[model samples]
Target: MFSPQGPSLRELCVQALSSVEHGYDLLAPKFDHTPFRTPQSMLDATTRALSGLGPFRTGLDVCCGTGAGMGVLGALCQDGTTGVDFSSGMLGQARSAYPNASFVRADARALPFDAGFDLAVTFGALGHFLPEERPALFNGIYRALRPGGLLAFPAGSRPPVTSIAHWATLGFDLALRVRNAVWRPPFVMYYRTNTMQEVSRDLTATGFTVRTVPLSPPGYNLVIARK
Candidate 1:
């Protein structure tokens, strides 16, 4: 599902064999061209959904890659926006793309913020964290947000087990597992790592009141949590 300008098979293979950070570094240049980038439709829908909750002053785009979600923050947040990511290469691209927004290089697990953001959003980054890691991740997001602030992200409806998409995703995760077992550094992308039920539970445990709203352009759901 990659475009002609997207990574070649060999390049993808090499990336898949590397650690998550390094793989994202290699992929950052062509990330927006791939299906991996959060789609514009979803971005628009999220913006619309968040607009009602906002008039927010400062917004944070967690794991912001290439700054697609920054556009959403720009529309919703009035004072300023910040995009935080661990990958320097990705942050570099985002800086170039959205010069107005401040970009920070930091791990999501240990966000270097203290109740500074009115709204926090992440797109297409949760699957990189295993299910066991959700608590810390959600806790960090909760910590980054100010009291009564919201955290938002788009999650898709699960594909039926009999669907080809389901099987393909399963196969991809299995392949990644095999590669990581024999490789030096593990590429941590897995298709089945995040589930709605688990995510809701984790957010609740982390002191967020979680709710899902259907996003238009289909196949997507918006998970909005308030601290």
Candidate 2:
């Protein structure tokens, strides 16, 4: 699923062996060319889904790798848009791409912001954080949003048990578990942990009124968490 401009198999293996942060740093330069990058169609669908709730002021994009979600913020927010990511390499690429937007280097688990944003969005980064880590990530996002602010993200519906996608995802997670069990600096990525019910519960616990709206494509949902 990688293009010629993307990292090679050897490069990917090297990355897989490293910590998540360093791996991403090594892959950052060619990240946009990879399938791992959030697709443009997904971003457009997210933008359309969030438009009705907007006329927002400042916007924040958590775990904003390469700033793809920043485009969503730029379109919806009137004041300014900011992207926060822990990887300096990713932040550099993001800053280069969207020179007008602000970029911050900080972990999503311990976001370094107050109630300064009216809206926030993240794309295709949920799997990076494990279930136990969700509390810190969501709590930090809650604190970063102003009263009556919103945090939106897209989540896919689970595939049917009979479908190949189901087995594929299950296999992927199993492989990741085995790797973590045997390797150092485990790469945390799982497909099944962030269910809609689980995420909604976490958001509610963090004081956000959680709700879901159908996105453009079927089997995808845009979760809106209001502060």
Query: What is the C-alpha local distance difference test score of each model?
Result: 0.90, 0.92
Please count the clashing residue pairs in each candidate, in the order shown: 0, 0
Q: Give the C-alpha lDDT of model 1.
A: 0.90
lDDT of 1 by residue, 9-71 (tens): 888877787788988899899888888898898899999988888779999999998999999
Q: How close is candidate 2 to the true structure, as a TM-score?
A: 0.98
Please state every model's RMSD to the true fold in angstroms: 1.1, 0.9
Query: Which candidate number has the best TM-score?
Result: 2
User: Which lDDT tens digits does candidate 2 get at residues 1-227?
Assistant: 37889899999989888888888899899999998888889899999988888779999999999889999999999999999998888999999999999999999999999999999999989999998899999999999999999999999999999999999999999988999999999988799889998889889999999998988679998999999
User: Model 1: which residue pairs collide?
Assistant: none
- Model 1: residue 3 alpha-carbon error in angstroms: 2.4
Overlapping backbone residue pairs in candidate 1 total 0
Native-referenced Cα lDDT, model 2: 0.92
